[model samples]
Target: MPHKNLKQTGFDEMNLSPDVFAVLQTVGYEIPTPIQTLTIPRMIECKDLLGQARTGTGKTAAFALPLLSRINLENKRPQVLVVTPTRELAIQVAQSFNDYGAKMKGLNVLAVYGGQSYSVQLNQLKRGAHVIVGTPGRLMDHMRRKTLCLADLTGLVLDEADEMLQMGFIDDVEWILSQIPQPTQIALFSATMPAPIQKIAGKYLKNPEKVIIRQESDVTNTIHQKFLMVKNINKSDALVRILEASFHDGVIVFTRTRNDTMTLTKILEEKGFKTEALNGEIAQAARERTVNRLKNGSIDILVATDVAARGLDVDRISHVINYDMPSKIDPYIHRIGRTGRAGRTGEAILFVQPKEKWMLKQIEKATLRKIEEIALPSNREINEKRMDDFKNKIYQTIGTEDLCVFTDLVESTAKEQDISISQVAAALAKMLQGNTPFLPETMAHKSAAKKKGTKAEIKAKSPVAPKQKQTPARLTPNKIAPTEKGMERYRIEVGHKHGLKPGDVVGAISNESGLESKFIGAINIDYDYSLVDLPFGMPKNIFNLLKMTWVKSQKMSISKYAC
Candidate 1:
């Protein structure tokens, strides 16, 4: 039977190294997610394993923590290779590896993907990297040119295997796997087990340990989930606008870190909202007091971290605001579950940065619901609400109390100043408004137009759009004329007969010189050598580096070539 319902109270039970555990603590993760609990031990044992979980399930840490602990820092050659389906994921996984292994000095981790300067990657590889994270196509390019040597590779991981198959990269993935040495540990993770992915696993893996994570909770049907596209710098302002416009009885704002709770609570309190901070740093008695305040209407807003807010139930909580998106999807489910309880409707508002659309997508996929995108509350809406509230207070005072004294004072002031009663009332209202603007500048106009740009422009500028693939031009040695501007043609010692392709030469030069591929000019294969154009004014150090670089068992022996 597949591993299910494995109980793990904390990460300590996983036996991870102190350094790795320390990183986890700093990241605010005390307990392991289900996938982490099931996968970490088997990976640490160097067993071939399969983990089936949707995105944002802490899969990166599940594999990364164990692999980081086993890294042999003394040997800098690539020991572990991770294959991702997208450059974004490649970068994210690479960063995670770097973060988790931060305590391990001399741990060299590189992320290789298309659209990045090849020169930088090549230089890093030449210097020696212990771990490499990359997308399939770029990894293949590096492997074919032997820039990414896997002879020392001790383990291999295929993250989001199903995505690779869907993106038509399974063949390249397979070719990459074929290059790994025998008896090397392998792990494959995917959300679903389709036939093709299963075939690759069956062929490549040896009695793999399998763990499948099912959805932990169904997002409450009564909770209407929505997201706002806001920048990090503008989130606090946008959050305030949301509070001012929306009608919420009690709100619980979720932040990622303990310090964030304190910071946001201070900001809200300064805004004159009855707000309190609840985090692990607070004492139990203080926390109880804070909760009691929320219960008795002394505090209507509570800023908290996930751990601190666990097991907290307040029926008055009509809204849940994700001030910081949770690192994992499971926490998101729990965070929103704080509201919409007992068959009552609740609202969950997520503040999403542009780079975090991937996480947003993961939340939607896991929840099986579409989170509607909403614009921030407009200026007119906020001002109107404030004015309505101000008017309602005056009307309530007039209806409930004998206002004879206040009315006589207003009449006396108006008669003495020889002004209309309306003028006197307006003066009092302005004084009551104090420094706060009665009609604040429109919010969405300034934030939306200035910070994010127009919607059409934002969509056009979205990084989610796939980058255009560049196909190398086929060239003969004779056609190497009219070198592109600011580019100098150079000749190398290896060509087609050496089993060299255009990609190999480009990868080799780009890797050696740390020059971006876009700056690298044309390439033409001669009988026994190849000619390629590189950026003008090549540095002596880079030239020397290129001369020593190898491709297809041949030294580059690079020298400037005239057309």
Candidate 2:
């Protein structure tokens, strides 16, 4: 976010404490992001602020540095509370606080969120934390149980308020805001200011200083975005082909549901990948371990849901594969933003179904870039890549490791078998390959299609399924059809009155029913209920489960809606 033309320079100009400045210097944060440059000073002065900044624009550090600078490490009774939309962001913000305040003694920052152990949070609360970071639900739960004492809380941050609004946490956030003491300094950061967000700012934030940052379009310039058209059933095969053929330092494969993350992780592992799964359900310690593994080269691939991968920043991740496309454009941006960090080039590949092409267009329009259509990696390509990798592996081993014993064995074996040394070496390589062949068979069909031309090949390999019986479209008196081709509308019992948002319904249905986001269609919210379009042939078991799935403490009570 740093502007090259801006005259203002380092954190020193902001008159930050030496302790905070030293910690920043140690972390190599020489230049301030635009949000940080503007918001830090106001936060330090204990003034209410409203900052409009994107997630990756260093907003966390903007608020964290100033808050830590003014933190009373002696008292340690929840002096600052930061509420985020998701557990991943909460953990990230808490980590930022700890990293920046490392020089300060007796600094205890606690991150509490749903799916985490309440007993652990209670224990942490009893020990008295100087700062608390958590999601709205978990924070409200703790506050309701009288475990989180906010009487001494001096500073508060509502980070990503728009996300909270979109996730249907606005009511809970407002309740939390109403409970905070009148004198508490508040700072709210949101990427966009919708009417609801603006209303909240006017109501809860008093005389707030405003900092608006324009959205940067150049973030994705270094990332090559491409889309592969594939059937839902063929995604795994395509993914395997892509992984085998594409060169990447590290890859994050994005899936819609947590279960998909686990399922995909196992599949990749079975195929001999150093892979791990990250989701909301993963324990905090385990999540941190998985992320650290990805960071330290212990794991070369990560399969994660949108919520789990929210605050992820791994510079070594050279590729982001959207195994299942997101329903929203914002999430698509956030997912790809994980890569191309530190000015390194990256790639984002999306798997698109026939029905999801409209959403792809929406994403293209939102990002102001055309996502080039790319064919799935052919078997011949995979084989070539495998051969190259095998040769490289042998070369690296010869250069780095001692092969004297193996060389002698190969030589002796060749002499004993009356065979050439080359044959013996080839046999050893075959033995090393074992069940996994180094060079897989090339696709004869693909080669034939290619001979006919690129367009012909695409048509031949098109993901459209063979003609099958279609479900009769059900019509009511209103005579409305589902917005998309293969989706059917259904009613959910929670809506605007319950502070429902389209994302909440999508997330709930996907999480509870294991339906991928791309399968979800248009969502319309009403007063006390919402209508959503889902894939027409949802399994009965999933339907039954979703009928009782809870969102906002209310049962979904899903039923077919003719609208």
Taken over the whole model, the C-alpha lDDT of each candidate is: 0.82, 0.83
Per-residue lDDT of 293-359 in model 2, one digit per residue for the tens?
8989999999999878877877699999999989887788778978875446789999999999999
Instruction: Name the TM-score of candidate 2.
Output: 0.72
lDDT per residue, candidate 1, 340-422, as tens digits?
76447899999999899999999999788899999988878888888787888999998999989999999999999999999
lDDT of 2 at 498: 63
- Candidate 2, residue 30: the lDDT equals 89
- C-alpha lDDT of residue 502 in model 2: 76
- Each candidate structure's TM-score, on Cα atoms with residue i matched to residue i, is 0.47, 0.72
